[model samples]
Target: MTLDFFSPVSDLVLAHNELLSPQALGKKIKIHSEKKGFPELGDVSIVVFGVLENRNDVNYIGEVFQLNEIRKIFYSLFPGSWNTVIADLGDIKAGETVEDTYFALKTTVCELVKQNIIPVIIGGSQDLTYAMYRAYDTLQSMVNLVSVDAKFDLGDSSKPMKNNSFVGKIILDEPYNLFNYATVGYQTYFNSQEEKDLMDNLYFESYRLGEISNNVTLVEPVMRDANVVSVDLNVVQGSEVSLKQKFSPNGLNGKEICAVARYAGISNKVSSFGVFEYKPSKDDEMTSMLVSQILWYFIEGVNCRINDEDFSDDRSYQKFITLVEDQELVFYKSNMTGRWWIEIPFLSNVNNKLKRHTLLPCMHQDYIDACENKVPERWYKAFQKNSI
Candidate 1:
């Protein structure tokens, strides 16, 4: 079993957990330890684990890191009135080769997901998302990947894989499981003009940092359609993180990043989530606390999830049809949750990547825009991609 690849949580963290209040999360979670063996997964809803591989990072210089501090902080916090059961599955130590580590992670994630368990991964570098994405190859026909990062990470696919270039590999590699890739909180200066052009040419989605910071709710609809969500810690503003972990002077604040995490957690289709690009430092209390809170919000969102996606019955949703120019736009609003979705019309002549008509999550404003004779950019992109 791939569980054997995991090392038990450190005794120091367990000792710390002993000091936490009975009502604290640390006291309630099922943890893997040297004496306790692996925890039973029968009723667990979320599994938290760490990956210790970082050689693929472009700036790597043999620095080692640990998630013990993050665990300690997360355990000390009090969970909300939550019913979801969480387990700490310990960490995956670096293997002899990065590929070996990827194999173990991919296999483990695939196993957990097949059992209807969500895996919240804390990683050493963002490239580990590649392994997370690969885990879905046999599980789903097509995958939607959402990356919260400052850059597109689409380096030359012909070159060796690195943290900055793994997305290129995902787009160019075999099996072709990735259907849509989106970026949230990207800074234009960090990406090249060619990369931006490529994103537009391919009909992928991207939202700038300025756009998201102005209105964080914009992330909800995009996340609702995602299957795999990967967050690069570098997306967090430098002031919100530790000295070693900071990537830019400007990025998502702690609250914004946590909100993004919560949105990911609330998505029914988001099976796997990851927070990556951690560089440990001596003074990491702030970063650790931020990450812990991010995890907390995600769990909170998971516990608050509502099953409002079933639109088979007329009683479950309210449908609206609007004419924008010559296009007929159809939208559905869940009677239970009030969330909205726009439909992508099926193409009879061309082979469809989605294979059938599907709903793209959207906001009420999209319906308003269509009523004004302005087509929503997201609907247009989805329509164009379907035609392609």
Candidate 2:
């Protein structure tokens, strides 16, 4: 039987007077409610879709999630000077089984990405990230995933799958498309020592909450190199989100999280983005608005994207080389965006995926550290991965 997984946007919600206002995003975009077909992909396009499947949440006790609460706030906000064609593709209702829902999401995401349309997924649970990651299998290439969360979410692979444990599945599963995984805003108390060691042993990257909260711009280079980005709303402080059920006492503030979202959107390589673990509360208007602004900032960043891929043009980029010990560290800075990247030398005849990726996105501080004879941690990690 053909699974009709997607439900059209409810007309009842569109009937809201505020959503139809001239300044509302709902008025400016194509909605899936009235049988409007998919938007044509031109220079840039974004398709927003929702997945309503939370059975996989480890804390699930058979509670329903109201995603439209976030949608209402999102559609009510005005957009920036964006040239991209934006569409609301409505929701993917939970399937008969969680796996069925994953299959539906996987298929949908793969199709959208193949058409060069970036998918902004609003998900019921973080485990939905597994399906999002699987969508890249058809593309038949390695992937770099960055997760913004309070926990590493790398639960035991031998155990049953849950929202908190999905990353383990992604790392150990077949097709093995994952090349690098980075967790931002992780709290040390939430993750075990074993997990921390595993992160290092696997050559993956993890940033503490304090490290990123102190300077949100530190994540720019990290996001610039990502192919997919996932945000767990729980990463934001409970005070900011005002959700007692799934909020953390210490985490990224509203501004910081939104900044991270925009950074993810600004990346030229990022194709898919997902915001998950959003448990709505009747009293929390702030949560809804914050989610709305996060999405808006992401769109704003997408509009600000510059073409920095062509490093061959000498005029477009300035090159710098630093000698540390016996190694030469080469760096490039873009004239268009002033972004910096360091070259990781490819190992000879290496059949691994890292051989395909030579440039490691870095910051000016990294270059300064290199000049001081201290090898940047990111450069060392990238070199180690390529060496393997």
Candidate 3:
């Protein structure tokens, strides 16, 4: 079905461009803007991807700005040859399916990685997260994912784009070399009883927003062990945030989001992160500029040139993780206070810290031995010692 995007709202010459104008706020949700002119990307690189869909009476206007908006937004942020943000323009047609979307997204990301440029997906839906890993599949065993959102996307079933089930399929299906995957700022209201049960069984770690607000100690490492971070914008506070199928009155604010993003960037574990689900119609006058600033924050995080104003001098992270930490994770349990916790030391991959990692940690009897012995050595030699 061809979703009727152009409403009889305003008399703006937006029809002059590819994107149409909305007559009022919170009514129509299509917010696609075109990139006006060609721009250069020397040492700087970016790829902004956007997509949208419609369901029944609801128009899923998740793409923040259309192709035209892409052009203006990029130049507006960087001004000159200081940066290059290529707009990976999504389609206006309504018949796009998951597989089709996958093909488009996979191709785009692969191209970006091939060019050695980081891709920025503004998001049409959360399923794009899977498309991202698919595009960049080398993350196996080495990748650490940090999701800053309000719900766990660790679902095993449900339609691909149904809600938060997409990432679960990836984790379950792939031989992912995932180090530590953590979900931040989850709200109790959004998740069902069954979902909670599933998460507990799956062992995917999650932190409730209430916990973070109540205790500042829990927020730091939320993005700490992560090598790749992706932010679903729906995690933001609904009172000030617009454009969505679901909005929570209690969520992260702009400063909080910036703080989290800055943390993710400084860790250097973050290669590329994305911001999804912003609807232009529901967006406030301040929305575009805020998004533009958000884009700048991302750039500042990745750039070789450092900003002392926002630089994270917290070398405490150095004691915990490094590029090679994922493969060499051998934990020693500590009976601290009342609960038992493991202190995992970071080791260089070249020095061979993976005393336990193998083709499948689940399949190895050595893993069983190590877990029981609390020793990675006994397990490591088992493969060589027991093999005749």
Q: Number of clashes in every candidate structure?
A: 0, 0, 16
Error of 3 at 241 (Å): 2.0
Best TM-score goes to which candidate?
1
Report the C-alpha lDDT of model 1 over 21-72, residue by residue, as the tens digit: 9999999989999999999999999999999999999999998889999999
TM-scores vs. true structure, each candidate: 0.99, 0.96, 0.61
Sequence-dependent TM-score of model 1: 0.99
* Candidate achieving higher TM-score, 1 or 3: 1
Question: What is the per-residue lDDT of model 2 for residues 210-290, given as tens digits with 9 covering 90 to 100?
Answer: 999788888999998898899999898878875544466899998999999999999998899999988877776888888
Q: lDDT value for candidate 2? A: 0.86
Highest-scoring model, lDDT: 1
Give me the runs in candidate 3 sitting further than 4 Å from their true place.
Answer: 1-42, 52-96, 156-161, 175-179, 214-220, 243-246, 304-388
Error of 2 at 69 (Å): 1.3
